[model samples]
Target: MILEPKMIEEVQAAVQEAKCLGVRGQGTKPALAMAWGETAVLSTRHLSGILAYEPNEYTFTAYAGTAVSEVITTLAQNNQYLPFDPLWVEAGATLGGTVAANASGSGRYRYGGVRDFILGVSFVDGSGQLVRGGGKVVKNSAGFDIPKFMVGSLGRYGILVELTFKVFPKPRSYVTLQLQYASLHAALFAMFKLAVMPFEMDVLDLAPELAGKATLIIRLGGLPEALPGRVERMRGFLQEQTEVETAVLLENEADITYWQAQNRFDWAFAASQLVKIPVTPKQIPTLDKHLTNTLRRYSAGGNVAWVAADDMTALQTTLTELNLAGLQFTGHTDDPYLGSRKGRRFAQRIKKALDPNAVFSTND
Candidate 1:
């Protein structure tokens, strides 16, 4: 409970001794990985700061406990960004914890997810021995993508200490546009069209609660003049083809606030069980019908569904009926969080091979 390990040696000792280790930056996504009681907790508050950054080479290496805010601030000094738009910025979050949880936000739509950006990692494995995987540079003929494997593992394999990521230069400007549609079918169809087209949206999300009304927010970043042309093109395409009742362009201070709300949904469900269900684009309708009673908010252009509900039985049954993966966030031990691994036997075997000791201290 009294976890404030500052040094790497302390981290190794804590990880080796505890039955399970819960590493957290800011506790932003408390529902991310359930805490197995009677375990050692490693707080990355002390292990914070940017270790190195090179603007020309497009690379940044920082300690695990480094606040994403600090990283962004430092990156901004050089006009750079993480591109992934890591969440929980207000709290003291760390780079290592972020990679361990594999938590990504909507900005990931442009380049990719955390898994795509993280180039290397340093961790204290189950044996308390420090192991470094991958290289500091952007390109490397590494043995394998060890960093990617660590992602979404949720601190089950080891205690991630230091992280190295490829960075991108920040854009000149940004614009947010709200495109309205008369119905879900129309909005989603228009969204699908925009997705396939050759354009990059800062974030694209749909809020379809009011019957016969849907709101699709499209974000664009670039030189100021270029944004209007793109927005006009998007507006013309939607207005001419799709049934658009109206369209609104939100900018300056208002746009920032709107995107903030759209981005920070994970923290909203601190007390409830936050379940992430991955479904195909075609399954949204089925999901809308099946999980109607449950409080649901979607992100990543509707590819990921976040459901906060206290009832595990109903959630599992609905997900099972739809033949989808229902990853539970919080619940009694009787019901597993990751609903079904369908074909994860191989993954289980791989975990066994890597850690070998079955790191009893991790939250797999």
Candidate 2:
């Protein structure tokens, strides 16, 4: 059965009653929601709306169940946005769900991810007790830092009721430069070179092209008058200093549409399974070798890989061989986690303390 709580008290009551509860928002992540097994589902959809938004103060508090799309629209009106670029907003991803999953988009290359922007959170613990952490301001430095701890917690500790996040002023203009490389090795070499150079990139991504080639996508955001010159300089530098086969400049609508599709994961729309693996650029060459058949994109300068695969078993085996782990967001499986599991001992200790009664399903 599913319970939709419209108020804090209602959420608490639902939590207290369920022996095994699965917390969810709008069910944007079906695979994750399915991992809960036969447990009772607690939907936060009804408990939605912005509690407070202070554009001048650069922070906003909203019910966890509130849609991220709503927050983005509201922030856009004020010329401010969440720097982490919360993902799945176009598919009705909720603020709390994004926090629970720790999902961020390409822009995370600049300002950081969900954990970096979250200021505070209010949640109902496993025992149905209301708990609060952090504050609704940017300079908060007190308590157990529970807000950060809750990130990627996946509702194992508590059900988030409200969330607060800091925002930044939206950039006035943007451009993307697509640099082509003859091979993955060459592309990664260029990325390492670009990393040390003095360029403020808003997004850095790499994708495979035909014939074993690769494309390096770089986004620059700033004043409109200054963008053309910046793009030219960056493009010229890549042409002269790196093994770039071609450099194409994308601007205005083309730039916007390209990034929007990327952030939305449109390329993975047809895949049966979608998994996120944390990785470094140094490991990409080896990982790429094993994922030739999979649709993959390396984002945030190769700090993360989003893989869309048809063969979960083979993919899991490959990740295990590499000593890497992946968090599955789509497709069917007995477990949402693939390959090597990390930090289980520490997580178990925290889970015991927060949800001693095991009211929240851990899917372990």
Candidate 3:
């Protein structure tokens, strides 16, 4: 693992000499979409520090290696936050890894993902040059929007060394409401129906284990006065439609823990294949039905499904049959990644320009 020093020249040399740049924040996400064979990992831990913060402008810039926790803390102190709450608690995940992996917790359902929060970024391209994209402010649209393209690039594009995000003010109060359903089908249906209403959700997830049955966890973030009534109205409508016998009101911390587990691939699906499938909400049902025994968790918020299993070939075939693609998270030695959009010609172009030598992980 490469721990980058603060000096720009040091970063340049490391990128120049490395055969493949495995950019990692805390090595928390190494298993998913990883590259082996003569690859050198870049740990941004040492390059860490907050470069700038302008709360008034809702903007903050930090080194890529800066811990996601640190940034959230700073934002909180200012009564603000990275609205797209990133999920890297135990892994010491960095800002770069969050963007590289495009990993965000359930809170993403409210506003958007890292793609929506990222205003700009700084990086050392394959050529080992220090470069910057997007302005430091919130409203600037000066040149091409390269930062977003790098948001979910998974390090195949360029090595992200620093980032700038347009932060959001913290909510006054947050409340979580969970509804127990007899099955995932029912819970998912309730979630999709609620998504269209005039509601603000910090998180929405389904937990079938402890519930002894499937359940959908819906979290609301807003002012204190508004929470009780909002929860009541939502509850009435949900109960009228589904077989929800229980509506558990979880405290703030409890809600956070539930969503983080999903974001970090926790709760012990260890050493198995963790595949991500992206499709429209309607397609989720069809795809979920195809998984013979692979336990599934569909992030109805992001239209991303997490499939866990010990088999890889079957996962690939199933995904292909459904006309979907996924990034291989964890699995056997030679598991195949479902890969990018078949016609992502523009993605290839961006990857070429940022990593002309294809110095990062090459799924191709």
Q: Which candidate is the best by lDDT?
A: 2
Candidate 2 per-residue lDDT over residues 227-321, each given as its tens digit = 98888888788888787887788899999898788877888856568899999999999999988867889999999999998888898999999
Worst 10 residues of 1 by lDDT: 329-338
Candidate 3 lDDT over residue span 127-149, tens digit each:
88887887655343665677886
Model 3 lDDT-worst window of ten: 332-341
TM-score of each: 0.89, 0.96, 0.89
Q: Write the per-residue lDDT of candidate 1 for residues 1-364, one digit (tens) a residue.
A: 7477778898888767766566666565565534566455677768777788888988888888888888888889888888887865656556876786666776776777898888888887777789787775434355567788778766666777888889888878888887778776778888888888777787776656535466777888888778889888888877776788777888777877766665566434556676777766677777777655556655577777767766777777777777787655443443335555564675566656656676533434
TM-score of 3: 0.89
The runs of at least 3 residues in candidate 2 whose Cα sits more than 4 Å from the true structure, single-residue gaps closed, are: 136-143
lDDT of each: 0.71, 0.88, 0.74
RMSD of each: 2.8, 1.7, 2.8
Better of 1 and 3 by lDDT: 3
